[model samples]
Target: MVRYLAGFPTPFASPANAIPANYAPNYQYLANPSEAGSLIWTLNMELTPIYAIAPEGPYANLIYDRLINALAGQLLQRPIPENFAGGINGDAYQQARTTFSNNFVSRVSIPGYLTGKTVTLFSGQVVPVITPQLRGLYAWHTEILVENAIATAPEEDIARLTDALTGFLDRIFFDLRNFGTSSADRALNYAATNAFQTASVLRQATGQGMQLDTIDVDRSPFCRMDSDCWDVRITFFDPENNRRARRVYRFTIDVSDAMPVTVGDVRSWPIS
Candidate 1:
């Protein structure tokens, strides 16, 4: 059940480095053998195979290394307190260590081209295939990300902002979960992970006593030549004012290539 990269046969045997030259012949062994040398790297959301990762390009070996290290619980590193000692606040240290350890591989941001091709895994479940962009691959801890996002917030606003941002992210991860294949889905996923715009929007809305009401992604009517663009809207509403119009913030993201990017500045206005 829990096997190391060493357990996999050759081609996959040397997991510490470059892609094996013999990887092509082992296509049949992969969960999705649709492409030569494409290995199935399952991206799980709480044990559910959300997408099958097919790391491409010259840095495929690096991608595999990250995934394998994450699986082995070696991807995250937390510095021990300088004052740490045996039996001297050891319980607190242990608790902190446990919490940090549990967060390993809890959240991963993989920006990739979600292909139309689908593959059936060994478990018989079908999932979309994605060729990851090397620069966008990030294995993160949700708590750390949240902390970083709110690190500069005023002390008085930190508590509420933390709650609002955390809740918003939870909704994306659970309620609006998707297969990451559609352009809109890919754009939305990219926006959420990138977090700069979303975090700014969340902070602004929460500061004004508004709640994150809905997140919507739709194909953008405006697009540059040969580019696939989508608009992601995050709306917030005042619970106290039932008749008041909602505030909506929208941004355009282009998913035309392997890596998606925000096309322009985020725009916001009130909408009924």
Candidate 2:
């Protein structure tokens, strides 16, 4: 049912930009939980709600451009915990909200949303407020909070974005290590491009096929195998014929000399 509704793609900003490019809340909080639940839950990206009410199409983006420009200096930075109720400035943000409300109803792909819709957002729960028109329902807002916590001296938001990607890369590499079976091939699947010192044992997919379930990154000191690395969940097809067989791989990457994790070209394995 929710699938019938549209989702606004979260926007991303360049690292070099001095001010946030979007009015969407500008910071991210990656959780390093004390316990491991499932994969997706562990890898969620935190957010402070970014409230906007607009119609889609030419006007949707235009309104955001206006709004961001309206709050130029305040665009990007860490979200204040107290501001979870919504934007910090009542007058300014309310103005932007009103601007969206007044303008969108008549625009192309406009949402039938009420004048003052309350939009709530969290890590995995950014829902769109929309009503279907003859043209079908469409997303109303796309203004992503480009991350609010910014400092001229702090680690750039772009770096956090990079960390987000690399962290996932680390997860993928973490998964690929146990990708295949040993009887199928005693050899491991450690690619030359992988930065981890531990050569992951790769295996072959036998019996039942397996799904590349989910990638979970462990950020806490107790759960993580390394002091400052990851305890990642990886899956593989095993001799038991289970479709969801998995393993946990751990590696600590030194930040001072860290390199981007790269996935190598897939090649035919040496059959045992």
Candidate 3:
């Protein structure tokens, strides 16, 4: 079995010298299926490749199809270069870039298991290989994530909620970034994506003038026999009177199997 890992699904031109000397500047060429074989897929964090992806098993083709779809989507959103060989005009190109820029574009999330094998690229860099799990694969944009919960919030409240949610996500992606090898890290990584419950709790907390205080993961005492579990606790407190009012929400995650799952309902309590 491979180690579990999560990161951005980034596509790259494999070899440093893969680009042809006379390659045309046309973007349409990228959408051609024939060109797909030359691209290398990788799971990246902070724009650094952590693992090179090599899809295996029955889902390989499906994974490839999804990746190609992401590429096609990005290309469709990109503005054509002004002097490109393609006959696309200036107005259409500008409009495409403007729309893409104004909106919060979604990025593909590839979370799965590593094959415990290493592969060397043409550039002599070696990276562990990962086979993505189709179950957790998704495309997400941060604002789109919490928009439904805060739909009717006042304009000022909406901004605060978005900040709280994104701050939680950014802290995980940057501050607590890890390989997802340990039971705790896996639970935390999974929590970062499946955060709708957290958002809901945050809405309730913020209404009472609470702010996110801390996030912690530890061994779960409530685990079933023969199962490995961890409890992820998200705490909130009143900024004005930090010592007097606080709340803690906890959810248990079982990671004994290849895919981790929530054990039961999210439990919460007060901490004064």
Candidate 4:
């Protein structure tokens, strides 16, 4: 998910007066500064839930049953007197034999059966029962938070925030470049150039491309250690392909050194 915060624009004086006699101003500016253009964007996101399972039972009993079954087939040895008989020789064995015989007699002999004339008949039947239980192991919830700062005029706070976001984007692009291509610096350049071309083509397709006349970059005033700035101009072809219309976009980015760089050319041009 992604969210965007439209920030206030920055206003400044025109540098047209600084142009030399042979140079021309790229865009006209008011003698007095006004609010910069508005930043517009839309935010979108989604939420999803995660689920897990758990089990419940008497773990100790289960372990004991498993252990007994596993060792049941093992052999055991005990010493006995050499002349000992198989059964009924010792008092302990006799007692044990008597107890077993009594248990068997109790199961087979019914009381009051001596009354021969009357007999009772019994039918055996068994009923089965089943029970099941379910438990929830874990539950999950997702949330999305979005914030926006809309300014009627250019503000320092907006610039700071935008600068921070641009830095983040630069790192992301750098890493993407490294993974997708091979060189990070080249990747950054490719992305920048592509952005310019895409904007140019989109505007041209919409009839606004003709309004663009030229594009350039200004490396001065951009902090080398913290920020990157670029000046882009979009130019429109004239009817005679001589005269042109143009617009400029000044972009600044902040990034870190840990980002990966991409390699190779990323330009895609239409075949004419």
- The C-alpha TM-scores of every prediction are 0.74, 0.19, 0.73, 0.20
Best by lDDT: 1
Q: Write the per-residue lDDT of candidate 2 for residues 202-258, one digit (tens) a residue.
A: 212211222233433343254223323323333333445444335433332221112
**lDDT: worst 10-residue window of model 1:** 20-29
Residue 270 of model 3, lDDT score:
95
Best-performing candidate as measured by TM-score: 1
lDDT of candidate 3 over 1-272, digit per residue (tens): 01011122222333332222222112343345444445667666666777887777787767766665554443332333442222255454445444544332355567777789987766787889888877667655555666765676788788877878788888787788888878899889888877676677677778788888889999998789999999999899888985766899899999887678889998889987
lDDT of 2: 0.29
In the range 88-178, model 4's lDDT, one tens digit per residue, is 3655435433332322110000001011222121222221111111211111110000012113213544444333333333433343322
Stretches off by above 4 angstroms in model 3 are: 1-38, 72-107, 152-157
Candidate 4 differs from the real structure by a C-alpha RMSD in angstroms, to one decimal, of 42.1
> Better model by TM-score, 1 or 2?
1
- Residue 103 accuracy (lDDT) in model 2: 29
Candidate 1's residue-wise lDDT over 97-209, tens digit each? 65555545567877777677899998899988887777777777676678788888889988897898788888888898877767888887887687656778888898788
Q: Which residues of candidate 2, in runs, are more than 4 Å off?
A: 1-200, 204-211, 220-227, 237-245, 256-272
Candidate 4: list runs displaced more than 4 Å.
1-197, 204-206, 209-215, 220-225, 232-241, 254-272
Judged by TM-score relative to the true structure, which candidate is superior, 3 or 4?
Answer: 3
Worst 10 residues of 4 by lDDT: 105-114
